[model samples]
Target: MNTINTHFRLSYQIQDEAFKLSQAGNCNLYVAISSRAMRLAVADVERNKFVALEDYELITVFTPLQIAEQLRLIADQSPILQEQRWLDVRISVSNQFFTLVPETLFDPTHQEDYLRLHSNLDPQQHVILYNRTFGLDAVNIFAIDGVIYRMAQSVFPERTVQFTHQTSSLIKSVLHQTDRNAGRVMHLFVERNYVTVLVVDENGLQFCNVFHYLSPEDFIYFVIFVMQEQKMNPEQETITAWGDITPDSSLFNMLKKYIRQVKFGKRPADVGYSYKFDDLFDHRYFELFSLHFCE
Candidate 1:
């Protein structure tokens, strides 16, 4: 990982020798946004492979206007993001303003009502939206910061940018990666200040939620709590993890200290990645890369 100190620290960047700036029109751009970080990946559609990536870390928590400013700054300076000719652009907004409602109980006219039950929405500040979870029989009702949403739309003015919640991508990716015939398993995606826990069984998506924590102890408490609530035994049930974690990191160590079958996750098997990505941990960009599977 290479770090370039700037408005937002460039934590990691890698581009394949085959990637070409002029051919961006044939590529798909995937961007993941959060309070603590922003990341983008470029995939060459004709080749069906990811060709480049840029991961940026925010120094501090940012509000709507501040996040919009950061997005503007990054778009102005980023080599790949500045291009407006992408074949498609999909963005995953990572925030606590999303809730899942069973498809049978969902009503399109009541999107705001569904989200209001879980998040405090300001009509002027956030734009409420929804994404259908294929095969899961649920819809993810979410609110994206209006400033940030407009900035993202401005970033790619020519095409209709597809916006989705980060958990939506995680659900699509995890369900694709897990063995449907196998027993239930818990998947955790650890970000800077929060952890998203997803439990999948042979039937389909069982449980999915995010927990904020300030320390390693706080992190494990949520993990164990989810396990107990799902009737999963930490001693025997498998817990696979991905994102912002390393084998020697405090989070991983703590997970092992508690859960006996802790394991690191891998990249989505369906999408091909450039050899340039070999230097990265397989689990690091799971959500960003999984955007390929997002509708």
Candidate 2:
């Protein structure tokens, strides 16, 4: 069955043979929406494994209203999303307008002030929200277009919705996987037009930021620049990559040429996936899968 709305194309839809729409009450739903893409992942708590996923890629940059309309179309056709009741529903927004503040200095009332330092947010057009880091002493201040938030609310009006930023999901998953004894680890999460670089070490979250790149050269430049700024050696330390990249892709090849040890990352180990998922790359849909770890 093809479910391609004019605005967005369904790239892939995978589900376990045993997944049942009637049993959605036992499943948790995660929906991640960004300007360029939208994704859905379903985890079955009863089986401790992910049972379904639907990934969509947008042809062009979409405004908040356009994104919401596409989401509504997906909701109308996706069997997994058609169910009225689910055990849990979490939505994450991926955008450039976000900033992280240490919990010690975070004032809930000054969220807009904190975020303004990094990106501009129009109160009338965007909603300012924050999510506390799972294992770190920080708060991620981010914005979601009002149109998108309201659309999600309308789609799942019967269920309580939890909102978060894509960065929150990446940081939580990286922190959980970081081994204190391992010294320092850098992760590159490649999106359609941007890359999120995260640096964590024995001490704590050392650095996290996003950089937009237009070419493979620009992509590797940002990677190497961040390593230099952090005093890491590309010829020595290992970097793990996730999302929007294939092993034989030009992006991966560029990384390998510049860095001595580059490897693909796997999903969170705590959660399992159905055998059906084995056909896919473990590194793909990391931010969506990592949402499972969000509070």
Candidate 3:
């Protein structure tokens, strides 16, 4: 019963159990029944199909005897898998024993040599680089067209020229990996203790912010300051706060009022204006701005 096109290794005994599980309809649940044993079964109810074993692009099932027979089969029968075996390909950090080639054919020392050879050939499409100190953590958020996409965490102690240069290089790598080169308006939220950064474009939004402070006002102020410093037009940008705080939380209530005050009336004389505590906490009084304003 071979339906999925992913490839990986499993013992003959486990493969027998997977075949039974696949037939039992348990494969549709997307649950792993056992971790100690290497087994995978995927059953798509919509398609009424099942695959007892999978890797990334190879899937097949054979009886315990057949599996053993295939282990001795020449590598030509599994062309793509054979190439992956020669290259010492690994799907992920886990599943170390899972290899494209049979265990008998594996050379432990050669694996490292092959990996080094291919490492430079297949550089990551995107790279993110940033530096941080031991005590403080920074969160980076990226959004495109009002939708959130990715978040990253970094630690920063002091601002050094080398650190700044490294961060710039990392940003370039990320952009290259994502294949996005268009101008993107980015925002940085820096509080006394931590910093949050946002990157936004037309596609959607991605948020990365740390939870160092409990107050939402601190987060909002940081966002506003970043926008102003970057010279982004307030009218053209959208800011969505993300973290442990929810939209209906008290902090969000204050933010709604703050946004209104900033956008609607004359700029206040006080750099950081204070609103009545009662008014700030009134959830009914705060209406979420519509998409026309945010989008």
Candidate 4:
């Protein structure tokens, strides 16, 4: 439950006093939850404005019970949790699940069976099932797990919130942002223990997979392996990186050594953010910000 990374800020710190005094009834709160951390961003929805309000990363833990307890404690202390209007929450699970089923046969009743066929673990430990309703009765549904779901619901009303795998938001944002004329696009959302690689062309998603890493080499290997297996040429394809990455992180340097375009992504252009969050890295917290458009 100890804090591994903590950075929480409010409007008055970054906004002019006049702006802070007048921010009522105009905002929406968005949260992105994962095993390693939790991030909160508040946006004045009517104005398309946003500011990342806080970030909390948990210290190393040995068990799921510890992880869940730590996550709840972090939520218990956030003042934003007390404000319940216009909330959108996304829970990220590391389960690498993808199923191709037709819409006619896609019954919500079969959710557990589909995931169970692919994963050999206790469903009691992970009880969340989320899918994309925006696509053509298409194949490839996602299943997310862990304490993030329960923690999210525990803090906010389940009826008023939207839930999906983190990749749903990541893929949604990247597809809209990627330039189709450019041919191929590769996006990497790097986190502490996981790296999600999403690849696409003008046609649509050519590949999507998440890899867990124990070292810098493992990270680079997955990057190269996907590009290789997908027949994407690193020399020609554009790779737009985002998420918890920084200019100095070894993940950045490792990608630079092998690829041509390992640049960071721009914040969603459709959303306006307060100058209060200017101190943050522009490329980070993208999924949390893009959750503004989830509904």
Query: What C-alpha lDDT values do all the predictions have?
Result: 0.90, 0.89, 0.28, 0.68
Per-residue CA lDDT of model 1 for 1-295, tens digit only, reads 5243245778889999879989998999999999988999999989899999999887754577777778888887898888988989999998889999999999999999988988888998999989997558899999999999999999888889999999999999899889988788899999988999999999999998889899999999999999999999998988899999999999999999999988899998877999999988899999899899886
Model 4, which residues run further than 4 Å from truth? 1-25, 87-105, 133-140, 144-147, 157-159
**Cα deviation of 30, candidate 4, in Å:** 1.4
Worst 10 residues of 3 by lDDT: 146-155
**Model 2, span 1-295: residue lDDT tens:** 7454567789998989899888798989999998888899999988879999999887764578888888888788787777768889999998888998989999999999999899977889999999897888889999999989999998898899999999999989988887878888899999977999999899978989899899999999999999999999988999999999998999999999999999999989899998889988989999999999896
Which wins on TM-score, candidate 1 or candidate 3? Answer: 1
Better of 3 and 4 by lDDT: 4
Order candidates by lDDT, high to low.
Answer: 1, 2, 4, 3
| Maximum-lDDT candidate | 1
lDDT of 3 by residue, 1-295 (tens): 7432323343321122323332332223111111121222233233433333322211253332232233223122422222211111111011111112223444544543333432332223222222221111322111111000010001101111121111222222222223234445553322223333545454423332332344667756766666676565556654443222345656556556544422111111111212221223221101110000110
Q: Clash totals for all models, in order? A: 0, 0, 30, 0
TM-score of 3: 0.25
RMSD of each: 3.3, 2.5, 22.1, 4.0
